[model samples]
Target chain A: MTTSTTPRVCRGIGEFRTALAERLAAVPGEASLGLVPTMGALHEGHAHLVRLAREENAVVAVSVFVNPLQFGPDEDLERYPRTLEADLELLARCGADLVFAPAVEQMYPDGEPLVRVTAGPLGAVLDGASRPGHFDGALTVVNKLLNITAPPGPVPFRAYFGEKDAQQLLLVRRMVADFDLPVTVRPVPIVRDADGLALSSRNRYLDAGQRHAALVLPATLRALAAGELDLDAARARIDAEDQVRLDYLVVVDPRTLAPVAPAPGTLALVAAHVGSTRLIDNLAL
Target chain B: MTTSTTPRVCRGIGEFRTALAERLAAVPGEASLGLVPTMGALHEGHAHLVRLAREENAVVAVSVFVNPLQFGPDEDLERYPRTLEADLELLARCGADLVFAPAVEQMYPDGEPLVRVTAGPLGAVLDGASRPGHFDGALTVVNKLLNITAPPGPVPFRAYFGEKDAQQLLLVRRMVADFDLPVTVRPVPIVRDADGLALSSRNRYLDAGQRHAALVLPATLRALAAGELDLDAARARIDAEDQVRLDYLVVVDPRTLAPVAPAPGTLALVAAHVGSTRLIDNLAL
Candidate 1:
């Protein structure tokens, strides 16, 4: 019943990999394991996901890799945050059993991977349509992580996701079902700030004025969810913001993420450039 | 090094899997393992592949599973040969270390699988075009086999195939490269009969007249290899025999299996029905 203060932290992919293998081997049997994959600039949102994983499974493996494949040539991979030491401290405090922080090269040694778990019909719409090859990268990395962490026996592994990335969660669920991978995918509720802005690592890039302007995206989405504004009107409200360069504000089916005419259960997805950083957030309506 | 008189024969997928695990565990850290996937009615062609695998790798594992996915709904699945005893004898003689004979239900308990590996450009033409979803089935089953038989550590598992199944071999090689699976694919030279007929399991279904008629397929292909035969002439030559119901006589690029202008390095493939049984053969020019 005693809590340990000192936390175990692994720096590089090789070191973490060796530790992970030993840890998995130590827990012989009857260990219910869960994985939370993330690009670790740990926030309250990530902690919420970790807490959920801890509550549901006996072991929690959180991977911190800013996957390069998911980033386009113009995207923010180089500038992506790498607070590994802080991330591990947070994970340990949040009751994570292992922190898998693999290097970019370790995850993809042969340059960019070609094995893409493409979303057949769902791919050419919403986030997929906007960011070409984004979901493919997400699914590929998830696939590798799932394979690597999957127990040697027939026991299935459980995975957790935050609802902020709703499209990613749905796509991953679809990929798992399609591939028949015996893994459980659970989605935790989105964590937001007092000002109604969804928590994101890119928030670090926003200056005072740009941060205030970024609030308009979540504000518009909240308005749509509360039925105060129509879809087009809400989109216009966000577009009116001066510092925010709107990429897309779409309403789509929650399952398929395909653009849908206003339905009862739909998702409002927002992507915009506040300053130079491109930030994305979504909410279920 | 004394050879045992009686070689072990695995009856089902579970037994074969258990046996394989035990065998692999016994030989720790030994490299150069090879796999040869086959359906159980072993012929000289299959034995040749096994022998090739034996010569190349320190350990050779052969799987005998008549994958139902590869066969069309109307094609032979039930009627296909299942000579487990004879097949094991052949494997033993060929010096295979382990023989994996899995049942249909063991392989696909949930019925038909959804994860299909398509040949993309190569898959949509020739054999792929003729037999829809055939390569998908072939690739899927091969992927499963490779995953199961892959080395426990960092070393890769090598697989052997016959050039007789030119399209299958090419598609499998494509799958290996595409997935970045830690496996080497080795294609053995095509083994032929004394009369130049490519050996196949379906040859057993041919009656005396039909068997004699089946020879025309290889003969016409050989003739086409020697000289420039127009598509129409090649078709006519393959269809010349009365007993042979010509299925398709396609000259295609060996790599992509797409139809090409009659040229050197192209593959001329023929499939015909001799009586109620269908037979296929291909020759690279």
Candidate 2:
């Protein structure tokens, strides 16, 4: 019924929505609602977002659902971890006031949504290219979440997204703008572990040797973005590593995600398979 | 200032949104807001929908913008009528509380929206097949309109749509259901003329002779639906007419728009070019 830190835990949309409605009703038209959406393998990165929301808002809600729409048939949809019990405990410590942990049937009651919101050219490259039709699915759930949590009147609804998934963040920001959605997306800084590798749920898949190999990704991105190492050098360094198989290491325009001509204001993003664990990380140039 | 009907007229989104916000605030937590979207060529059919909205809700907002998204590139975007003064007067008589008559630039400030709501297989047949990418545009604007008029929380937002544009009505309904949008789509019965022809803005393009030829369309649809005439006989009768070239005449599943095998529960729709003007009409089987 409750998390350790006074957070109301709601299993159904109706339950959470009513809880949200009562919270919004207390402060009519005041934009104090903040939403942080996640696929529940909550780590320090998700905690950081929730903490930011707690500081910025009176009522903060965290949604935990592993969106099945965003995964390709061959991808790790089934393999994706479900750690709600742990996620709730983490969210409580991070100060999330409420959690919407709906069943898959609740989020998608009528099966696959026929009407879908698509990210155009921006979604077609980088992350979107390898996983075909991924952003469209991600966006469908994101749109629904935004709508589901959207305030009744002109009440401010601030949504927090992690820049760790850089392309996903960009697409979400654009979706909010294009659709004139009521919520403003606030990008939280990407949280990193002490060793400099970006913390990710997929990192759980890496063995001891693979974990050591995964450090090369952020290191390569950092060197490339800092102008200390050229892309060729970065690629060569990543290739020399034993376990990691390089997927793509490209410098792109931060907003468009198009491969740029190595300018100062670019983002160096890398994705690779560190012994069967596919991981992505980006660094601002 | 005011239309003949004394409704507040808002020319820009900024103005309309603020006005709408204030209007919705005065009656907080009550689902009294109703929206009827149109392209500003207000005929009796549009007025009928607006009248229904006025009767159903405490506050009714009618939007009159000729959406460029729904118009095909080579289609009659330029030739579309702009009768704001006349439209306002009609809205006033229909008991609309306010009108959002935004300019094209206001509606699409960023030019073409990169993010769009797409209608899938349901949008691919009948009128959709004839005008590729048409319903997507329709759904996008409809989605925008719904969001703009969406109540901050869940106080009830009902959208009125005419059944005359049968495919459009179905697609909007599906889009609402598919996205789990909060608004309810209330379809009004088709408003017809004395001689059984569907009321349309493009009907003005019909000359005396074209008007007479246009009667054959509705007549054919009616006879086919009544089972008094078979598809072949209806096509022959329509083809035997003057100055009218039938584009398509098919009986389809009303929900999916897939072509049906002359079943009872179907929709018989017809499109024809009477002179330089294109027109469409449908009847329930």
Candidate 3:
């Protein structure tokens, strides 16, 4: 059966839940629900995720919530990209059945969450180190999205997240295991431009000159993956590049995110400010 | 249809999930599942919770885990009650459909949870102030239990907690609201003995003299609730009792748990050390 090109847009939590439930119940047997959660910049990466979900599940629900809880006081919450109309068009082409675009009030009717899912020691490193509470906010919203999309009875419920946010993907997997949440996590690889810059909504902030400087992020990861430079050499290479200010570059165990000797399955992660916009990228060594 | 008198005892997480799912699937229509979370050492109070679950839900699950995370280093982790056999017996009598009694390792296979549900400022007051991270641990385990027992599709799922642990009940309600968990929280009233002493598993630690002295806790609440004494007088009354050490006595708004003048619906909470055992009780003023 062909899914309708025009996916239903739900702005309220109760409406979305009820709509999804009705759709799932109408499935011939037990239905598998797939969720692609995004902040709604609707890039090629998001399209790839939605297409993958459409191919795998009986139904796909995409949540386009730029969660306020996940943003620091000084962060780009206001400046964060929100292109809902364009997002809906892309989701339609990608075969999404529903779009859950809740306003901040609908998602958090009770103001700030008193209880939140906290990422322990691991959350204090990398992006978390530079932007405190970033992972906590990301993980908390992801947790909420996962619960929101969960089916009433157990069939197959899976959520698709990009591997570009490697730390987030790892922490989300950890949370699912920790909470014993009944959804499976499917990781989609990092989608990059032809020039090899990893796709990010924040990439929109880059100027023509800053965009060229940001290539250092992917170049640093490629060099580390190719064994052309060691950890210190990688850091120095990014530091030497004009307009690219290195935040951190380290090779660590993918599972533990702890500094380790570069080896297969270890991940090389780098963050840099290309102009005023910060960008992060990772590569498996 | 009669539920089996001998509730299936599941020792593994996977086993319990599978067993519960299969039972739920067997229900003629959509099934409502009820959960009563406890730390074993079954008392009449637990039976009351289970019976309420029995009355309300198509299937009932009781989790008997004395979560180590909720206990502090200086507190009674080693000495906490464990009466699983008796607990199972009471559950069976109370018409519990299933008993999930996982080993610490089974519930937390990867040691302590790296990601936990934290009760914010509310967690740092009353019981939280006395025992740091206590509510955080309680909330984490409770979050896990709700997720574990959650059905695949949207069916009615509720978890029961006694009002005896007023702070815990309030925090659990908050966590459920914050997480937007699929489970409903069912609050059962505090079950007291004929003499008016609140039932507690830790009451097992009390000697005859301590047990007699523990009466001061409920008496203080009674006096405060009945307007026989104000907050200051209630503290003094509990302090004057022989062998009773006052911990804290305050009248607070039930919703916010903030200090409020004595009024109907405000909760009067009392905690004290009767000999070596610490006890807490609350009454609605």
lDDT per residue as tens, model 3, A67-109: 8877888889999988999988888888999999999888788
Q: How many collisions per candidate? A: 0, 7, 9
| DockQ of the candidate models in sequence | 0.15, 0.70, 0.81
How do the candidates rank by TM-score, highest first? 3, 2, 1
What is each predicted model's overall lDDT from 0 to 1?
A: 0.75, 0.85, 0.89
RMSD of each: 7.0, 2.2, 1.4
Where does model 3 exceed 4 Å of error?
A1-4, B1-4
Each model's fnat? 0.07, 0.67, 0.88
The model with the greatest lDDT is 3
Selected candidate, larger TM-score, 1 vs 2: 2
In angstroms, give how far residue B176 of model 1 lies from its true place: 6.0
Candidate 2 Cα errors over 4 Å, as ranges: A1-3, A26-31, B1-4, B26-31, B262-264
Identify the superior model by lDDT, candidate 1 or candidate 3: 3
TM-scores for all candidates?
Answer: 0.66, 0.95, 0.98
Instruction: Give the per-residue lDDT of model 3 (tens digit) for B1-285.
Output: 444477899999889989898888888585879999998998998888998999999989999999999999899889898888888778878889899999999999999999888899999999999999999999999999888888755568889999999999999999888888888899999899988999999988999888888998888789888899989988988889989988889889999999999999899998888887889999998
Error at B210, model 2, angstroms: 1.3
- Cα error, residue A111 of model 3, in Å, equals 0.6
Model 3: residue B128 alpha-carbon error in angstroms: 0.3
